[model samples]
Target: MKKTIGRKEKPYMLPYFQMEEDSFVITTWHDGQGFNLYTSNERYKTLERLISRLPKGTIIEND
Candidate 1:
């Protein structure tokens, strides 16, 4: 008989964000997940800058 090992899946987190500009939006997900969604802007320079400054293990609080 052979034994098999199972892999665990990552948990999903809720997303939250604030509109910073007409072309870009900043969003943070649960469990310290963060990313930016570009509505129309393709440059994405500002979004990249902001995400880089975020601290590790940082989560967004919901009201």
Candidate 2:
């Protein structure tokens, strides 16, 4: 199967891997059961820090 980005309902798989910058992978569901993405907004800071360390064009997979 082809790797993909974005929610399954709106997948941008091939195009997502073609871009040079400013591309995003999105998901409609939260990681933890019963805890939405917004339930812990504070994690964004740490997450941002970690992501910033990655080289440009890096693709992160939650799984």
Candidate 3:
């Protein structure tokens, strides 16, 4: 996959992720101040480990 980011007037486009199977994918983007992660998988133990590592204020969303 690919993405467009940065200022709307001068956005930057780049290749983002790749997957061969049906498993979920994880990709990150910069939000100016820091980084943000978007995930399509919800494997419990993986999430547990991820949550354990991030700072407390990180926002997590599920579908």
Candidate 4:
């Protein structure tokens, strides 16, 4: 995995890890109270499972 920086636009981007094996860009940003994760649709299930371990007000939806 290669760590890289994302675009500096709206909502403020965060550092992302690039998976060359699957060509995926995974990143997470905070919105003061919670976190917003950005990734490919294929990882939705995996992401959901991971977020399940976190507190209810952690991951922000519709971000």
The best candidate by TM-score is 3
Model 1 bad stretches (over 4 Å): 1-22, 45-63
The positional error of residue 49 in candidate 1, measured at the CA in angstroms, is 11
> Candidate 4 — worst ten consecutive residues by lDDT sum?
19-28
Instruction: Compare candidates 1 and 4 on TM-score and give the better one.
Output: 1
lDDT of each: 0.53, 0.45, 0.53, 0.52
Rank by TM-score (best first): 3, 1, 2, 4
lDDT of 1 at 39: 52
RMSD of 4: 9.7
Candidate 4 per-residue C-alpha lDDT over 5-34 given as tens digits, one digit per residue, 9 for 90 to 100: 664444545466654543544334455554
**Residue pairs in collision within model 4:** none
Clashes of each: 0, 0, 0, 0
The C-alpha stretches of model 4 lying farther than 4 A from their native spots are 1-45
Candidate 1 structure quality by residue, lDDT tens digits, 1-63: 333355555555664555455465545556645554645444545656544566977564423
Question: Where does the lowest 10-residue lDDT sum fall in candidate 2?
Answer: 33-42
lDDT of 3 by residue, 1-63 (tens): 334375345545664666444344444445554334444445423667677777999886644
The candidate, 2 or 4, that scores higher on TM-score is 2
Work out the TM-score per prediction.
0.28, 0.25, 0.31, 0.24
lDDT of 2 by residue, 1-63 (tens): 434465345434442234334433334556433221222233343656656766999776654
Worst 10 residues of 1 by lDDT: 1-10
